[model samples]
Target: MFDAQYSENVSHPLRVVPLSQLARAGGLGLGAERSYMAPVLFWIAHGQGRLSVGGALRGYTGHNAIFLPANLSHGIEISPRCQGTAVFFAEKSMLPFPPTELHLRMQGVQVQSEMNQLIEELRLESLSDSPDRDLMLFHRAALMLLWLNRQSGKPHVPSVQVSDMLRAIAQPKR
Candidate 1:
């Protein structure tokens, strides 16, 4: 159920979906097995659950963020009161974060606010029907990755890329 094929028909590769929305739409629920070609980030706003990644099962509580790398076997089962957001992007989308299971280290309130802001921006761009929404979402997600790295205290320094588009996304605006 986490296959990237589920979203292949869409215009862009980046997708930000609210967890509750997915639940209400019957897209996801308990006891579902899913593995994605793309990486996924789970921003748990509230509630607790157990998630298994690559045969390693871990439990998480409220206000936590988790990352599952591409093709990693991962899924979660939470109580009925869970609420959060999920971000899906291309397989190589999450640069700087590495291909590991990460429980993000949110150092302070300000860092948490920054993550929330990034998620909100992602939600907005995902909902917009503008022609440039794809490009916008890509850059926004890149920023989210960068911010996540910063929160982990091991930010990556991006190098030049194939095109200005990629370079722009890798480098924060000055």
Candidate 2:
């Protein structure tokens, strides 16, 4: 059986969706309920599953990562035991970097050991109610992305620039 919940927040050009509270009812499938209008970064841990995105099945196991472009239909099916974090933001969140470029860079890049560590750190940060948790996690997420991009042979961009873009994306629109 499949069961899921959906929640989202919109702040004009920036939107944040917290999908961490999701729990599979039958413990069979793991991952997001559905794709969103904006791009998404999924930091999944302690789960063995396969993600169906754009009509393709991308398999993932312990400490796996996946990126979904905006409006791309995707789903996750777990092996009865799964848990993780899903962070979604708009394509406009990272200005200057074309969405197509970012998507191309992230596609087919498997999560590595270091990336898994970063995901774990971000997961712990998310569990805390501390005010700085969000900021810190955002930084870590950007770093993870940067690392992935580098591994994929994508051109290097300044980390500071990425951080700034992430901050802008996280901010509530006026």
Worst 10 residues of 1 by lDDT: 90-99
What is candidate 1's lDDT per residue for 1-174, written digit by digit as tens?
357547654333677877776666563433565777777888988788887766667788877888777767666765568888888876555345543667874657887787888999998998999999877887888788877776666676665553566767899988
Model 2: lDDT to the true structure: 0.54
Residue 62 CA error for candidate 2 (Å)?
Answer: 3.0
lDDT scores for all predictions? Answer: 0.73, 0.54
lDDT winner? 1
What are the per-residue Cα lDDT tens digits for candidate 2 across 27-121? 32434546566666665566666767656666776555566666566676755456555655434454322233232222333544565566667
Task: Estimate TM-scores for all models.
Answer: 0.76, 0.54
CA RMSD of all predictions: 4.7, 8.6
Q: After superposition, how far is residue 70 of candidate 1 from its true place, in Å?
A: 1.0
